[model samples]
Target: MGAIGSSADNAAAKSFNAAFKRETLKGQKGWPSEREARLDAFHWLTRYNTRRRHSRLGQRSPIAYKNALPSTTIALTQAA
Candidate 1:
């Protein structure tokens, strides 16, 4: 684990946050209500997890990678 407030320890999370801010919150006027912002974030997260491709996954979205895994491998992964 990284020390508190250390970016290196939390690089992946920080990268995601930077992308979220850039992609989801960069330009538009602020949401009129907190509920709206929450809804937008939910939708964004859904799409990101299901559809966004990652270089480390050989250009597959996380859902695609998981789906492509063999059942036995998945079972072993879950068992662990």
Candidate 2:
């Protein structure tokens, strides 16, 4: 967003990754098994994407915000 290789470009992504790691890890060394790790990540991602309300989205969950939008239909035309 700012420039190539600029921190601002990936600021949002970095913040999200940090939050995911911090909350998922929870000060633990590591998960006991790969299965558990996968499960934990799955659960966290599910809740994060659909259940959590984001301030930037006006305190609505992503799904809720999307549902609030008016539906649009795109018509396709063949190029002559």
Note the residue pairs that clash in candidate 1.
none
Tens digits of per-residue lDDT for model 2 on 3-60?
8877798888888889889989999988999999999999999999998999999999
Question: How would you encode candidate 1's per-residue C-alpha lDDT over 1-80 as one tens digit per residue?
Answer: 58888767888788898888777776976787999899989988998989999998999999999999887634345564
Instruction: Give the CA lDDT, 0 to 100, for residue 48 in model 2.
Output: 97
Q: Highest TM-score among the candidates is held by which one?
A: 2
Worst 10 residues of 2 by lDDT: 1-10
Against the true structure, candidate 2 reaches a TM-score of: 0.77
Q: In candidate 2, which residue pairs clash? A: none
